[model samples]
Target: MAHQERVVALLRQPNSMIAEGFAFMEAQFVALHEDIYVAQPKGFEDPVHPNHVYKLRKAFYGLKQAPRVWYEQLTQYLLHHGYDRGSVDKRLLVKTTRNHVTIAQIYADDIVFGSTLQKYTDDLVEVMNKEFEMSIVGQMTYFLGLQVKQSSEGYFISQKKYAKNLVKKFELESSKTPRTLISTSTKLSKDDAGPPIDSTVYRSLIGSLLYLTASRPDIMFSFGMCARHQSAPKKSHLIAAKRILKYVRGTIKYGIWYSKESELSVTGYCDADWAGNIDDRKSTSGGCFFVGKELSIMAEQETKLNFSEHS
Candidate 1:
């Protein structure tokens, strides 16, 4: 899913790429019983072979081999049409020409496609519909839990509903709003002496935050700090983690914005906070790569060895 930013970068790079249209597709599949002896869907079974299992004509969703079989079929179809699969991400397919280009990304059952030419996009949609039961969802606004809003200026993606639900899920909807992602003056320790909280809820909250990080990099650092104490979270850690939700409450609409006026250049910046964690005295470092401030990549870590003094 992090590849989304890079995909946007490709769309915004002028002279090479232009978003003609965005479409979503779902592959049709017929389900067969996992076990040969097990009964299958009412009429899908073979007429001649009553006791024998029916052969699958297409990939069945929820089956272990369904994704692989579907990809195989789709891959062959795209390759037959002159599309080349990505070297890094096998699910990414690209077809380029002197005048135009088309890129398609496949995630499980859903596919998102865009091209430099509107005719190409339309033709691709028509062709895919002819071959398979393609859904032909026009102009992708929602995919994989991320809500995307496209405009003449650029694209905006966020999990606003998910963020609000998260706040309410933890019963913090009415809590005081937090301005900061984390309180700078406060220090969180192991807090082994403090009262313990439910590990299940704490872990679930962390998991939700991790998914929210897909479009909300602002909470990544604070989430990481709170995640480390998941093994045995204390009241202090819970309070700190809840602070992030309160912060989300205040800025529910915050999200990653990709402007169409992006430059075709990659810029990277990194920062280090020496001995930031009082519990272990570990320095925290984080970095982000920007394609003209679009935030293509983000990463952070807690380093046990202090390197600030050496530098």
Candidate 2:
């Protein structure tokens, strides 16, 4: 999915790309499950014996090899059409002829194809339609829950709708807004001996919040801190997590904006807060890479190696 972000960033320049979508289901497979056969569904039974295993000629959703088979099929198709698979990201396929360049990104069934020329896009859609089961999704807008708004100023990616739904899901729509995601003075340590909360509920909340971090990077650290205590989350930890939601409630519309005006430049920022995880005496290391002032990757990891936690 990080490849998905790269594709979107490539489109930041106005008129740099024209996109369309194509997606399909399972592909035909020559290999059988476990190199033998699998039990058929109740209705598609074997005549010899109902208990005997069966074989399949096509890949289906549930099979482990389905994704691999489907990818190989897609790769062969692209190669047959003069496109070269990206050495960096296998999911990316590219075709270039003189000045015209076309790129396609494959994610399971979904495909995002774009080109410098309309003829290339039209040709791709035409051939793909002839070979696969898919239809044009037209110009890219909303994809994978990331609401996209693209124009002369570049793109704005947000999960406002998802965040709103999350607030409602957690019953925090009516909660007070928090000035900060994690209160400055608040501290969450594993050995606090605070009253324990429902582990199942705490985990559920953590999972929901983690998904929201895709667009809400601001709450990433605070929300992730609460996740460490999933095994024994306490009332204090839950309150910290709720504070993040409270902040989200106020800035529900906040999103990452890629400005076209910014010059093309790359920068990286990294830092570590020593002994941030009090319970384990571990520090948190944070790093991010930027493309023309737009953040492309943000990573946070907890490191027990104190030597690597220098300011």
TM-score, candidate 1, is 0.83
- lDDT accuracy of residue 106 in candidate 1: 81
Model 2 C-alpha lDDT per residue in residues 1-311, reported as the tens digit of each score? 33433444456546655455656452333233345467768878877787878666667666778777777777788899998777768888887766666788888767878875677778888877777777676778877788888787777889988888988988998899978888677768884568888988888889988988888788888877888889888898888888888899899899998776665567889998788776777989998887667787899999895455566
Whole-model alpha-carbon lDDT for candidate 2: 0.77
The stretch of ten residues in a row with the least summed lDDT in candidate 1 is 15-24
Relative to the unseen true structure, what is the C-alpha lDDT of residue 24 in candidate 1, on a scale of 0 to 100? 25
Residue pairs clashing, model 2: none
Note the clash tally of each candidate: 0, 0
Error of 1 at 82 (Å): 2.6
Which runs in model 1 stand beyond 4 Å of their true positions? 1-10, 13-58, 306-311
